[model samples]
Target chain A: MASEMNDKNDKRGRLENSISKAGNMSGQNQNNPSPGRRKVLKALAGLPVVGLLGLQVLRKTNYDNKHSLQRQLVDELGLSDLMSSVKPVTASEGETLRIGIAGFGVRGGQLAASLGFMEKSEFDKKSAAGSLDAHISQGNLNVAITGICDVFDLHAERGIAVAQHDIFTGGEIAKKHPVKRYMTFHDMLADKNIDAVIISTPDHHHAWMTTDAAKAGKHIYTEKAIIRREEEIEPLYKAVKSSNKVFQAGHQYPQNSVFQQAKEILDRGMLGDVSHLETTTNRNSEEGAWIRHLDSNGKPKPGDKKSIDWKQWLGNSSYVPFSTQRYYSWARYFDYDTGLYGQLFSHEYDAMNQLLGIGIPDTVVATGGQYYYTDFGDIPDVLHTNFEFPDKGYTLTYSANLTSSKFRPRSIYGKDAWMAVGGDLTVTPDGRSEKYGDMIKRGLVNPSAPMIEIKRGALTASAVDAVSSASTRYYEDRGLVSTNIGGRIWDVNHLHLKEWIDCIRNGGTPSANIEKAYEVGVTIAMADISYREKCRTKWDPVQRKIIRL
Target chain B: MVSINNQKWQTGILVALRFLIGWHLLYEGLFKLLHPDWSSLGFLAESKWILSGFAEWIISNSSVLNIVDALNTWGLIAIGLGLILSLFTRIAAFAGTGLLLLYYLMNPPFIGMGHAIPLEGNYLIVNKTLIEAVAMLLFAIFPAAHCYGLDSLINKRKKN
Candidate 1:
């Protein structure tokens, strides 16, 4: 313990020294022109040439062959027509599911808004509230926000307002459905009127709330990285299973059209025997890096701490002084959250994992430090984690740099071809595919052609406006419903909530169900362990515990 | 000194050339990658020599432009790093030569076909780009830079 304290002291001292040195170096670099500085300047000067060359190559590559290859493969699999007509599988019209929002925070509000409560002005002009109105009018899978709970009075009030349709732009607004506000989640769970709960509380509170809700015979739609620790995962999953209640983890990518198409393309085995998958989370703003919304003075506004039940908000965690920064941006504190692993990489892992159905990795090796966002956060600004799944014959890489957004679209590299997924799905064939000369001659594959790019959804100015300033665009883009359904845009959050609510009403499983959530939870837990312990983390299937290497 | 199997002085000269050309190419690629707004439009647009029409057409087409941009950026970086690090030195030199040759042929510092971009040095149908391509060609022929690079380390491991 003494040595650990000493080590901590040493790290703090080193951090201070480095921060000062970095400041000094910036001013000193121009005059002294150190080797590193010179090298960087030279590299910077050559950028235009390289960018031009890169652009030219991208333009010149003939994608005709690759497109033909995809067409042939997709046609063979009878997915050619389905690819164009792909839509979120709507749940059969059923009785309304009564949803009790346990955590009325940002994500909780977004989820509620997505459930047809968002201010219509926030909706895209073309999308028309993400086509949620039509879905709500369909009456099947309709969700009535019966209860809203939050320790913070402000959050609770805001949630109740949105649910009651008092904060929206609808034509008529005489509260037909008055949503009840609860001070504690337990009260909401006890309300027999509530059929389900959407757990969007801080990372620390997820486990207990989800398990408790399950035990209460209520379905759950929880946020991503459902729990903070590995120990909580099994019990949480089991509780839902034992209760026989629908528990959907909030990983919204499964509702995305591009991802759906990518999955379809992968299912066709077009990207033959995928060996490598790379995903990235990058943003270049304070808001993007979990700094939370700040006031004009650049300091977080201390909320009504007197009104907020701070003790309950802390839950199992140790007590700390009331700080709005901690309450709002809980992601910045290790005591409350799993940092980037749970917040960002969990989404990336779930997206790729959903596409491939590859479970927890054999080993996780991560190296990162709080290099940039050192203001109040313990989480690293830059993180790179590699997961090796030898059994699956593939390696997954997750990299993020809050400092820069230069990485290309995340992709799956396979023997036959590589496919990238972002705003669109693009598949490029490898040169080795030329070995199938007959296929080329038969017009099934184009050896020298460029890649096949499929634009799955349209972008909306409103969508960008809604998210870009919030720094949640990174989160939105990764798993949000960016796909069009029946020529109308779908809200991924809405789709995810609908999936949960639908499953609650009808007997079906959600895409981000408990089983899938466990895999994602364990993977993220491994990443957190690897980063925190500064060691290679491996999962022992036999013991179901993290082993250090 | 002129022996085909081994010549210390000749090898030294080639290694220097390899490193220099590699550094140039690698530096150019890295710069472009780091710059967000960097594009090949001006370079491709100002093509006044042979293949100018083709270059202009490539610029006009969005898909083709994107493809060319990616290829030019990555190809230069790949070839540049390869030459600099002496990892796959011959292949790197060859690829660099090809890129340089294309640039030369596309604009061909030929007399009377004045480029929109200002030239650094005067040339009689041969400019700095052509000269560098020639150097890259020579570097490709004498592949001895691996003696001090990552390739050498790999070779040693294989031998061991």
Candidate 2:
């Protein structure tokens, strides 16, 4: 009976142990499944939100990436249209022309002196010693009168004297006839003997003076960018066309010899398929803005407006209170300037446009702000803008910053090579073996083989091994070489002036005529609109219109 | 377990944002420190129009100006650290935004637009200060600090 009781007790204990184990297993399964279900549900619920966030992030990233990539493409490539069939324009030898300049400002004065020096130097070298004297005697070439037009009475009582006796350098050209002084451009234009007129007035007056000069049958050589508004460009173009007078816009770099050489090399396909281009002008000081300092008395002096017609200065712009800052530094105000875009950027844009063979870009986007000193000025201290030409498969990135002096050397990146123009023309060739070799040698990267580096100068050429490493191992292997090209060959101002003079003397096409000037003006004006709208803008070349994008 | 998991995720997000903004500020300050030539103090001193007459006079004094410059450098570092660690977040954000606003007022982007075409010139519509201010404002408005940061840890301790 006792043995039977022990057996039953042992069996009961075993049964209790199995029951406890089963209970623990069920609890574990329930706890683990609950958490797993929770996780799955949470992940499923976040699908749309996460996907949406990712899409938005991608869009922003692509937008930012487009600029750098496009810049790289445009800078590296050369435009086929820019290499259009070249027609050499040759001028026949003719009588020395008598030229008289009436206005004197930064543009007017600079051009007058440069042209005078160029003409005198060329004449001295090319002509017989007595050729100038003979030309003057024959009434073909004479200094005539080179005096200032004081429409504003800025130069005291005496107009800026053009007579050799009146200037500090009078002795050099003392024997030449004194430049006849005129109080007004109208007075100068009225003289039938005066064959040409150079208008360097404010934007508002550019059209009026040029139109009048054309109507008077005098050739017109004018400073650019032509005007502010598209509407104005049309009228100016029409006026120049209707008058049947010779006209030239002063975008002189096109005539520069160095630029020509660069253009020639680019045309030769020295740089492979160009992909990007970038240009910048960084200025961190107020002087860069062209703000003139005030006089000690805090009053603007009369000489401030020397040779400047005050009324003509007002032109189509609204009348405002006269301040020396505005008078001397007309570029600081919107009424007289498109700020840096018109004054400085126009020059660069013309070069790029001419070189790219692209008209106003299909799209333009700009972002910038003033983060520097504040004064009476009303322009941003820093600005960055991008222009996209989809059809041309290129883009241009431009930046201006006043806060930092970091300067990026302007460059064009091509598929096979890169081209940089400033101090020298650097050509970087592309390939993979060159990059891989550098990486392997560096040990930082294990790549298959060595690379070659070629260095080219104006007269020297040398080849060196390329070390390939992970960091140095560029995805594209290319060799780079540089050569110095001489400066611009043609004087843009002189050529334009000569064209204008030639067109007047012999009716022919001017190099940068009214139509081209108008085109450039419209393009720049649209750029301003894009900036104002904070969106992309497009220009219709056929219709000559700007459409905001 | 659910509460702990949520806390961890939140902490991760807060950490990420703190480092993003904190590092930006810290980098700016450190850059100024490393490159003394990059200092704008001399520029500020030379400014004849922006600063008030009294401020200009004060800045003209070398001893006082030096102290102010040192304070500015350290203040930027402190603000960066505070934000990154989720310590004194409110104060750091406030100060950062304030500095940005001052920069914006100093040079505006509209001035650039007012200039030439291609709209390049001294304008004030877009600038670094404005961008930073917007970032700071976003940070200040969101509960980023509390999401996955020291603030959350502190709160958890308090709850326990």
Candidate 3:
């Protein structure tokens, strides 16, 4: 305060004092130099500080340029395409395609949101909260969710509410669609009003619902571990193939921009003679293990015998008494799902398939036990499965544990470099790599850290699951993930659905089409049989069946 | 020049502070300039407190984000050079204070608002950035740069 009071006076006094010291200087005389050399040196003293800062900055820049392995490797390996702009996927504009959603559960809701349907309540909250996550990409495919089929009435109503949301369709004035609920998906399939059906029902219902939906002339987008049992694979395959219906098996990873980059890295052989792929699922929470009947507050979630049609939910699976355990966490039971295989391993397998294009494995050996979560479902809390692709000399190892939410990244081991891919992609040059030997020896590529790293959203809309993940649920438990579905950014799941919708309208093969679905289906069946039956299962491609050994 | 010899220590301290702050901000700007991939999105994404809404508005728009990013880098560089060189020191000091205040507000050390992004020092609304901003305001009040600043030479030819 004291300094401020005399600020103007001090400035005037100092200026006059300096001019008086100069003795011959005047304020208007711009050409006048200082009277003394010492005074002149004081005025020019800022140059030294500028010099020091410049020197330090140059040193730092040199250090960074020297250690930048990513730049060197990308340039050398011709893998710069990984960092190139995301290849544009054509979202063909067309007439609105009416669709029915089966099973409006957790994944069902996610799929619907990805398909550009946000429940009014959720939209209000998500837009308010994650309104800044621009990666959500605001535009929607010209599609409408007119039908919702769920065994649980609450879920059906929720689905109906979501289907009726019209704000996100370019934020236009509310365009109301007559959304109806079907007690069973079969009824939804029978409706001529529905052009496609999204089968997000529990794993047991997938094969039948997808086959039925296809046979009924409705395009199908069914979620992963498409068929829980070995027998359903052929029928599901034949139905989709014979019906000529656009069957997009439920997987959204391929739509990720990073996935394309990862694929390019593999195609360019940046990894160099990849022999093994390691995928992992780690979770410490009950919800992560599919013990989701109870809410976060330890309260039982909404559902009951009266509201949920148990018989219809059971479907072809053997009748089980009304239990919230089966209804909420059906993935934990052998009757409905292959537990980890259906829930999480399917994503790992799908990611591996999409990256390597390695189809059905020759032999799959599964081993693990219910070492944790003893009070709950029959599925193992710790599981490990291996798929040997003899023809490609490739092996896939999937290790999952429900008790530890540690960051166990999924890695693909190649002779040159091993790539760890998740929410971000990192390709660490192997110390003993044959292909990168010269580079590592010359210190061009560092062996200690990844030479090539593609951070999510670096290329384009990196919406998790659609963007990057191991996937997101098991990746980083922090706010590195978001559930918002609004923005000008490309959401991967939205792109996958758009691809399905486009294929339906324009007739092109979507990445998650029937053939890939069949490969994944057989692989899941083999792993399931190997886990449950305590045997090693081998795929006989000629016979189109897995032979137990 | 009358008080120059008498207030040498005080003026020296003021000049040293000016140079140090200039060096710090200049390095920050230079680092961002060097790392082409560096974006304020990470910092803004984890933004908390009063400026978070403004941060979101910038983040949601890529062009706006780019503009903000470039301005932040260049603004820091220009202010830093100004402070060190004592060239337009008052404008630089005031601008520096505003920029520091933005940093302080975006991730203010207020309780419950400081945990999103891990920071270097702990503070109770008195972090180093806030201190720096106050110090910068001091420069706006005082002509410390006149002791050995390029502004002193220019001021010799004009009114304050």
Which numbered prediction scores highest in TM-score against the true structure? 3
TM-score of every prediction relative to native: 0.63, 0.51, 0.83
Rank ordering of all candidates by DockQ, starting from the highest: 3, 2, 1
Q: Compare candidates 1 and 3 on DockQ and give the better one.
A: 3
lDDT per residue, candidate 1, A1-549, as tens digits? 999999999976765454323322333435655754453443233344445545754553445445555667666536556557366456446665678898877788777766766533444442442333432332234567889998888888878767765323223333446589988889999999998888888999999899899999988888876989888988887898899888889888887777878888788787888899998888887767778758659876657579779899999998898778888778988899998788878878898989999899999999888877788769888889999999999999998888885645778988888888865677777767633445556666565653566664443332343335645555445536455666455566667777777677667898998889999999998989899989999999888888989
Q: Of models 1 and 2, which has the larger TM-score?
A: 1
Q: What are the clashing pairs of model 3? A: A137-A487, A137-A489, A138-A487, A463-A467
True-contact fraction per candidate equals 0.00, 0.00, 0.42
Task: Please provide, for model 3 over A1-549, each residue's C-alpha lDDT reduced to its tens digit, 9 standing for 90 to 100.
Answer: 888869978987885454334422222255545545645677778889899889887886788777766567667887655556356655458888898998999888977887677788877775655452442454557778899989899999899888887746444434577999987777887799999999888988999888888889998899887998889989989999999889898676777666777788788788888899998888887777778798768888889999999999999888779999889978788888889888777777888898888899999898999987888879999889999988898899999888887887889998888988766778898899888889988888888987877666532223332223333555332212332222235556667888899898998899988998888888989998999999999988788878999
Candidate 2: where are CA atoms >4 Å away? A1-93, A96-102, A117-147, A154-175, A295-309, A403-410, A422-424, A430-510, B1-160
Q: Where does model 1 exceed 4 Å of error?
A: A1-79, A82-85, A88-92, A119-141, A166-175, A296-299, A434-450, A465-467, A470-472, A476-481, B1-160
Q: In model 2, what is chain B's TM-score?
A: 0.67
DockQ of 1: 0.02
DockQ of predictions, in order shown: 0.02, 0.03, 0.36
